[model samples]
Target: MSETNSAMTLGKRSLMGLVLGLAAGGALYFVPECWLRDDFLINTVFKIVGNGYLNLLKMTIAPFVFASLVMGISSATDVRQVGRIGIKILAIYFVTTTIATTFGILGGLILKPGAGLSLGTFELSGQYEAVESSFADVMLGFIPTNIVASFAEGDMIHIVIFAVFVGVAMSLLGTQAEAVKRFNEDFANVMLKIVNMVISTTPFGVFALMATTVANLGFGIIYTLAKYCVCEIFLFFLFGFCVCGGIFTLLARENFFRFLTQFIRKVAMIPFSTSSSNATIPYSIQFCRSIGVSNKVASFTIPLGATVNMDGTAIMQGMTAVFVAQLYGIDMTWVQILTIVIAATMGSIGSPGMPGVVMATLVVVLSSVGFPLEVIGLIVSIDKFPDMFKTVLNVMGDSVCTTIVAKSEGEFDREVFYGRKAAQ
Candidate 1:
């Protein structure tokens, strides 16, 4: 009971912070430069609070990811159960992500958001350097040469690889590894506590972030990228509601609107405001559980989805590739468009769920198709605005996949899904 109350309090306070912060930030935008300096206010004040909160969340992620994956796998009933669930999750991810990428590309081609714009129209900031990485590079990068260095650097791909090995070994050992399993489970609990404490401060952090974002760029930049933003938003809704909702309806055999209402009530705000799906994992797991997903499935799928199932990021990358291509007057062949679809889908896997990181990953997609990297600078400043919405979509994708996998594995409770009974 106390835990439920605490969660409710946090949600209300966080929402208040989001609204107040946006209002405060917008008001600050109107302040004269002489009265309130950007250096003193934005770069110093907002940067410290916002980034500090994010850094706190990042700190929990490494340990949490390691411990949760270890616990999720080690505590499973059987290896075949793990493998079966894994197959289902991956299948859902691939199909939905491919469809999402296609939607994004189609939106870009249909909208032609960049057709009227010239490269000289927008001030492109930062050095746009594309780091070309092939599939072999990604595969090899998954195995860590130095596990210690991987943890220290917060490399999730390496951490996940190591965790899976440890988990599978423990699962095989069974009772012999019981002590180690308990230790990992306890450690995961500790990390969840830390995450909850940090989540409580979300209101303050989001306020600072929104305030700084508005103060720095205001609404002018959004206007410049309005068409591109609109296209992305449209894709998010079309994919989130129509595609994802359709899947949930067909697979879960429940009403999508009902699930959506409960999802919004339980888990939507955190991802929407924080723009970090990793930060929202604990809440997502709870939300899944509330809808009757079992502990084993929820633990494994939500965290794994945090790293791999980035439908939202995939959409943005696909659209951006086409948008940037149009901006530079570079006509991409059908081969290049196909490359964008494949690259975006693969690149989104294991991509860090951090604010504005998509701008960095888009480099790989753009490079694959030989799009102008400099065009990325045109959208970097405004990435944060779209990032919030993208994150909501990202986690919603996670929950949908989690629900479907849970049902397939017989780990779901239909009564809870329909709100006829509370999850126990």
Candidate 2:
């Protein structure tokens, strides 16, 4: 009863935060930047509090993920199980990312959001130049050059590599790994407690984030990006409910509507304000636990998902590529379309963990088929809205993958998942 009440309370608080964000954005949208004054309310008050909340969330992310991953890997019977789990998660991630990109391409080609618009609509600045990175660099970079540096720099992919090595070694050690695994579990719990505490301050953070965004972007930016935003949202829901919810649940033998509403919706809506999967990791893990995912699986999959799973980002790449192509009146060749699918799938795998990492790598996706890079600047002013929704999609995809893997492993508690039995 106590745990149920706590979750309920948290859900209400989260909803209230979202509402406050909407209210703030709507109210502030009417105010001119000159009248609003960025230094006073936007910076000193809103930015400070909002960024403080985000910082607290970031504070836990790397450590919590490290601890969780170590503990999860150590719990596995051997390296084979751990290897299998990693491969499965990555496979799911690849399939979903490819699907997302394909849909994104279709959305762009069909909707033609950028078609018939005058080039004069967007002032193209040839200002930003991307220092290109090869596919080889991305792949070779995954192996940790220095394990300590990976953790210190918060290089998640490398950290994952380093952590897995340590975990495998510990697992092979048997009795020796027991104490270390327990310690990692304890550390993860402490971080989770901190995450809950940080989440308690979300209402204020949401209010700040929304207000600042609207005040800064204003109505002009919204109108310009409205078409793109709509397409992204539609694709996000289509993928979330239909792909992740409908098809996945059917395969897992879980109720689609009931499954989404029962827990996923409660937690999945969070990234609208937070906008960072790193911050949302703990809450996602909490949701997994509530739905009866084993801690071992949740710990491994959630963090790994946050780092590697970029379905939403892949969608952004595909759609935005076509959107840009349309702006320039360039018809994409079939080979280029295939190139986007392949590059985005691989790029999402190697993408960085930082906020706005997608936009950075968007260049790679675009360059594969010779999509204009300068158009990136035009979209920058309006990327926030898409980024928020995409992050939600990214997080949801991760959760879905986690749940599916858990069910397959017999690590899921069905009664608890459906809310028929309370989570322990």
Candidate 3:
């Protein structure tokens, strides 16, 4: 009862913050330039508060994820079972991403968002440079030569790899490593407690972040790219509802709408406001636990999903390819479409989960099919809107994936998941 009440109160507060921020920020955008100066309000006040809150979330990620992974794997019944869970999770991620990308491409084809517009109508600045890394590089970068540096740098891929190594070793050591396993479990709990502390301030943080975004972008940009934005946002929901929710329904044998309500009631606003999958990890795990996913599965899957799962990013990249092709009057062949899918899928894996970084991933996808890089400039202006929605999709994907896998592994508590009993 207490847990439910706390979640309810937090949800109400966070939703209120989101609404108030949008209202305040949108109204502020219409203020006279002399009264509402960017230097004083948007850049100074909003930037500081928003980034400070974001930093608080980032501060917990490296240590929290590391400890969770260590504890989750160390406490597993068997090493082979850990490997099996990993394989299942990866398989689901791959399928979902591919589906998301396909849906994005099909949406672009059907909607033709850029068909009527000429390339000269919009400003083309090839200002974004994609730091292209190959699949080989991404794979090689996973192993950390120095674990301390990985944590210091907040390199999630390396952190995940090192933690897995330690976990496997502890699992193999049996009774000799029991004390270390307990320490990891206790440490994860401590990190989660800190995360809870940070989460309580979400409403305030969300308000500042939203206010800053609206003050800068204003309403016009969203209107300017209305078609493109609409298409992207539609795909986000389509994928989230049809793909993620469908998987949950098919596997969990529960009502997806019910699940959706519960999900939104828990952590929807954080991802939407922050535009970050990394920042939402702790909350995703917490939500999973609330629905009866085991700590072991929740800890392992949620963190890994944050690192590798990029369904939303994949969707964005795929749509961008078609949108750019249409804008440039370039006819895309089957070969180019295939290239987009392949590149987008591989690019999303190990990609950074921070806001706006997906633009970098989009560069790789566009470049793969020889799309003009300048088209990215137009997308950049309206990227935040889609970024907000896509982050929500990505985070939801993480929770759904965690829950489904938990069910399959018999790690799910049906009573709690179905509301027959409250989470203890």
Candidate 4:
């Protein structure tokens, strides 16, 4: 075969190998105990590859997030535009998050998925170290004491703030700073190239992540919380598809389902598998750009959305709170429900860009409103399942918010929004 054809064949083989590996790992998870003990080689291969993939993804996260944020900020035109976009983005983020949490709470109340469950003392193995930052403290945290330290710690908010300041300074210097701006742009491209290199191995990582999860914690965990899981999934689809779609349709004067189908065809799988809003940032940014949202709007809104606009997390918080309350037979007053909405909304802003951060924030919010802390453990076992769905909604929310903001700011292309086939 010619070199090009040989390379293409090898690429297809590699892709198939990754898929087969994942399937084999998943199958091993359901193998009989006797078979598992006899199949030592099979178990060894599955464990090593699956665990190795997760570590690789984790390794890339800190650098990818910091670099992506820095690149985004450095590309902005001015601090004033950044500030304006920040404010608008945050406003929409908080409002929609509050609305999402409310829907979750409302759904929980009506569904009562956890109703009549007996209270049990459950232990939480996952420990979250509290970063003591009030609203003012969080604001102060944005000003990095050391850029390297911020990047090392993966403090996204701080990185974003520092990048904005540097970007502003670059813009101010104009002719003098052109070289620096160009260098930064090149650096950003290099980092993105690294991200692409890492993402190319995603199928391997995903297979391992899924295999380990299934093998260790079987589908039994989900079966146990079957009702609660069903209710949360129902609410997620309702709010994400029905409610958010309706708003987009009304605003854009187009069929919401059609728009969703177009967008989802591009982004649906990434968030579903990764279960992270931050990880999906690049995809969300590209999706916005493809739909004709300007670079300025896409960069500003997508990063900010990843940081604070957590519709899926909000929904989980509301529903999980009520689910726990029902499981523990705790009576929640009207005032308590209102408090949940407020706390969940605020918590989304403070929550770290980690997979289970919302679960930690949920404990804080629920405890603040007089719910038992042990109840959090009950939800933890089933957290990953709902989290996957929540992440999809989170990305969807960011895209919708970006589209709306771009439209209002006159940064959106009408033709692109209408799904015309053409280059961006």
The number of the candidate with the highest lDDT is 1
Residues 321-403, candidate 1: write the lDDT tens digits.
88887766666655556667866776676455655446545655765554555444345434556777899999999999999
228-336: candidate 2 lDDT, tens digit per residue: 8788778888778777886476657887676677555678666666667777888889898988888888988888777668778888888888888776666566655
Question: Candidate 4, TM-score vs. the true structure?
Answer: 0.59
Worst 10 residues of 2 by lDDT: 122-131
lDDT of 3 at 45: 81
Off by over 4 Å in 4: 1-79, 120-224
lDDT per residue for candidate 4 within 62-116, as digits (tens), equals 4443444444444434345567666666667768889998998999999988775
> Positional deviation of 365 in candidate 2, in angstroms?
0.8
Please provide TM-scores, in order, for all candidate models, with all chains considered together: 0.61, 0.59, 0.60, 0.59
**Candidate 4: deviation at residue 373, Å?**
1.5
C-alpha lDDT of residue 310 in model 4: 81
lDDT of 3 at 129: 22
TM-score of 2: 0.59
**RMSD of each predicted structure:** 8.6, 9.8, 9.9, 9.9
Clashes of each: 0, 0, 0, 1
Quote model 1's TM-score.
0.61
- lDDT values for all models: 0.73, 0.67, 0.72, 0.64
Error of 4 at 111 (Å): 0.7
How much is 318 displaced in model 1, in angstroms? 0.5
> Model 4, 286: alpha-carbon shift in Å?
0.7
Worst 10 residues of 4 by lDDT: 122-131
Worst 10 residues of 3 by lDDT: 121-130
